[model samples]
Target: MSALILVVDDEPDVAELFRQQFRKELRASRFDMEFAQSAPEALERVGAAEAARLILILSDVNMPGMSGIELLPRARKARPDVPVIMITAYRDSETRPKAIEAGAAGLFTKPIDFPELRGEIGRRLDAATGPQ
Candidate 1:
């Protein structure tokens, strides 16, 4: 069975972009991706039984109701074993520190480097599952 990755972003287009970028992996069944357009939806998904397959979370920092940084600690509380990586278009001085302090596993700036992100995901999944 493939591991699950949850992606949370306010923008509607972000989901399509992730699907396109991770198309090969998705086709190969290396992992499955799920999208949550808001932090509340993400939290629901995280707390659900479906989260049993969850290994990672990719969340945008600037959502309307709850920013990714704000969601970080709550998500961790819900599923401490899963790692959360924050993504932001802003990437200001305060963002990084706030994310880290809130328990983010990593942070990525927007117009994300997909290859690097993929590598990081691979590493985390590898570490989680151990040797194939």
Candidate 2:
């Protein structure tokens, strides 16, 4: 089965950019991508794919209706095993702790280095799958 990644961001451009980047950057054909523009939408996707097949979630911290911090606990409730990594333009000691406390696997700044990010994501996904 393919490893699925749910990307939640209020910015359509950013979401699409990541989608394209994932496709271009990932060597694995079994990596599937999905996107949501809001926290509620992300939650819905998580609920729908809560079964063990789903792998990871990458979300932006600042959004109109619900920030990533707000969504983290909720997502965890539905899919505790899935790791949610928060992305933001503002990365500092203050925001990082809040995200960690809220249950983020990690935090990344925007203008993300796709190659590096892909490597990290791949590691997390591999970790989720356990030993081969």
Candidate 3:
């Protein structure tokens, strides 16, 4: 079965960006992606069969409600094994520590580098699934 990635971002375009960047992997059935515009919505998607296939969650830190940092624990509650990476344009240094404390596996600053992100995803997935 193909692995799944749940991407949560308040900016609608970010979802498209991830989809486009991962197109090659998606086409190869190496990964499948899903989008959620908010934390609550992302939490809801993290269950059942989808949860089992989900290898990673890429989430933006800033949002209208329940910021990514706040949503971290809740997401863990639903799917404890799934790794979450925080993506944001904000430069506040404090955010990183908070995200780590809240259970984020990594924090990535934006204008995201898709290649780097993809590399990290691949590494994490390999670690999770044992070398594809």
Index of the highest-lDDT prediction: 1
Please give the lDDT score for candidate 2.
Answer: 0.84
- lDDT, candidate 3, 11-116, per-residue tens: 8988788878888998998878889998889888886536558888889999998999888999888888888999989889799999999999999999898888
Model 1 clashes, total count = 0
Selected candidate, larger TM-score, 1 vs 3: 1
Question: Considering lDDT, which of the candidate structures 2 and 3 is the better prediction for this target?
Answer: 3
Q: After superposition, how far is residue 13 of candidate 2 from its true place, in Å?
A: 0.7
- lDDT for model 1: 0.91
Clashing pairs in 3: none
Comparing 1 and 3 by lDDT, which wins? 1
Tens digit per residue, CA lDDT, model 1, 71-130 = 999999999999999999995899999889999999999899999999998998797777
Model 2, 35-60: lDDT tens digits are 89999999999988847668899999
Determine which window of 10 residues in candidate 3 has minimal summed lDDT. 43-52
lDDT of 1 at 124: 80
